[model samples]
Target: MKKFKKFLIWLVGIILVVLIAGAAYLHFSAYQPSTAANQAVKVAAEDNQETFFKAKQNKLTVIFYPGALVTPNSYAIWAKKVAQAGYTVKIVHFPLNMAFFKVKAADKVVNSNENYVVGGHSLGGAMAARYAHQSDNPHLKGIFFLGAYPDEKGRLDQKKLDVLSITASRDGVLNWSKYRQGKKYLPKTTEYYQIKGGNHGGFGSYGQQKGDRKATISNGRQQTIIAKKLIAWLRKIK
Candidate 1:
């Protein structure tokens, strides 16, 4: 009997160690903002650790979630560009830097008086779509994804919300098969854009990510293209 107890204790200890090591890997694997993106963080406003970038507040707001293992500040450059075009943007900071942990976190950021949209990059975008699919918030007008798409459960074929999907021609990190399958989940009115020569990491100011294809275009050029697309989408939301 004593031997069995000892074995049980040993097994529990090994499981704990493995869990701790896995957590540490996730922490260390987070993508950090580049110097320029880091510097831009200074202008951002904070609400309970969530970051906001609004040069001029407007009737429309965008709530963004970071991709898995991506720091929120990594998206400051993109947020700034959208904000400059007269929209308020809030970037959610997730526990463990993963958006799936807080799929409906956008609820706290929405205002009944303002028209709103939710979006994100990579896995963040998927989680945002999950929230959008299940939410009944009347203020939600649209959703935009950056190199990401919804899973089966986030179906929006009958939803009234507008959808915009932006992808990179050179992106190797995104699952193309899943992207194709995700088309059935989007509304009939969904719009799509692809950035030529851009890679997955170019969507944000973070440096190249592991397992992503090399981008043939400069980050500035890629960002500009994304900004233009976002601005054009925003203009149509009214």
Candidate 2:
């Protein structure tokens, strides 16, 4: 019995060590934002909220969550593009650069008086869906996903929400099985698009992801396509 107790203690210690190491890696290896994109749109930072604003009033506001381990600024280019098209974009910073740590972080940026959409990439998308599914925010009209899916726990299909799910054609890092299973949880009217030649990391301007497939198209092209589609979808919202 003493030997068994010793083994159990050793196993717990090993698990704790592994968890700590993984957390450290995630902290140190987080993506850094690029400075090459010209600041044509109004970029403002407030606490964890990074806003790319246009001059238009009554514009639809989009609150975006970054993928796990990706810095919120990595999505600035896309946000700026959307802003240039006359909509307001806000990229939310998650605690520890992981959305799972703060699933309702979108609440901080949402304006209850304005029309809005909530979305994210990868794990961020899952948490965004979780927030939309659980929250009673009447301003939220839609959900967007980039190489992501709704969390199974929330089952967004039950809610009367519009959804747009965009996936990459050659995404090596996305879990196909879970993505397939997640479709059942989305509404029947969900608009789905697969960007040909795009990869998992193409949604943001961050450097190449470790396990992601190489994108066949340039990041600029991918971002342009995403912005165009998103803008079109927002216009369709009544």
Candidate 3:
């Protein structure tokens, strides 16, 4: 009987060691980037033209939200360009950096508007999708996704109706693997724009910062070029 107890104790100790090791692996793994190893590149200042084509006489309004765990300042430059195009663009400030709650704030900020569009980066994009998915907001024109993916729970269904999905060719952050998931919610009518030298966090104000993470391109000129393209796309629909 004593022998059996000792053997059982030994077995328990072995199981415990394995469990601890597995947990350590998972914890460390989560800290690693989802993409390849590259230096965090700094982006350039915004020098795009101030010309903005007004889509509507009253002026089209857009609610812009940032990505998860990202600050609103990162996309400041992009917002300025969008707003410069004769559209009133509102960049959401998520105190918690959580897109879900941040989107709720956007709805309230945009309490009432005859013509309004919603869009964001990464998780922010998903938040916009959820907002437009609801049938109540008929004025919600559409959404733009920048290196953003839809949640597995069907919140990204808006892409099927009126959505624009843009991805940077060199962006490892939102690589093809991560982008493929968005396809399920994309409609045949949805438009796709591929930014040649863009990265996951390229378009925003972070353009000139090395940032806490690595980026695809650090060239200010290239980022500005793509920013111009993004503005052009917004104007095309205008």
| Per-model CA lDDT versus the true structure | 0.89, 0.83, 0.58
Candidate 2: the clashing residue pairs are none
* Per-residue lDDT over 143-209 for candidate 3, one digit per residue giving the tens place of the 0 to 100 score: 7777776655535554434567777666656646757866777565767887676666665544322
- Whole-model lDDT, model 3: 0.58
lDDT of 1 at 140: 91
Per-model TM against the reference: 0.93, 0.86, 0.65
Best by TM-score: 1
Q: lDDT ranking from best to worst? A: 1, 2, 3
Looking at candidate 3, the ten consecutive residues that score lowest on lDDT are: 33-42
Using lDDT as the measure, the top candidate is: 1
The residue pairs in collision within model 1 are none
For model 1, where is the 10-residue window of minimal lDDT? Answer: 48-57
Which residue runs of candidate 2 sit more than 4 Å off their true CA positions? 1-24, 37-42, 51-55
TM-score of 1: 0.93
Tell me how many clashing residue pairs each candidate has: 0, 0, 4
lDDT by residue for model 2 (1-238), tens:
9999999999999999999998889889898765543342236454645544553664788888889998877777777778777778888876679888888877777766888899899988998899998888788899999999975776798887889999999899899899999999999999999999999888887868989999999888888888888888888886
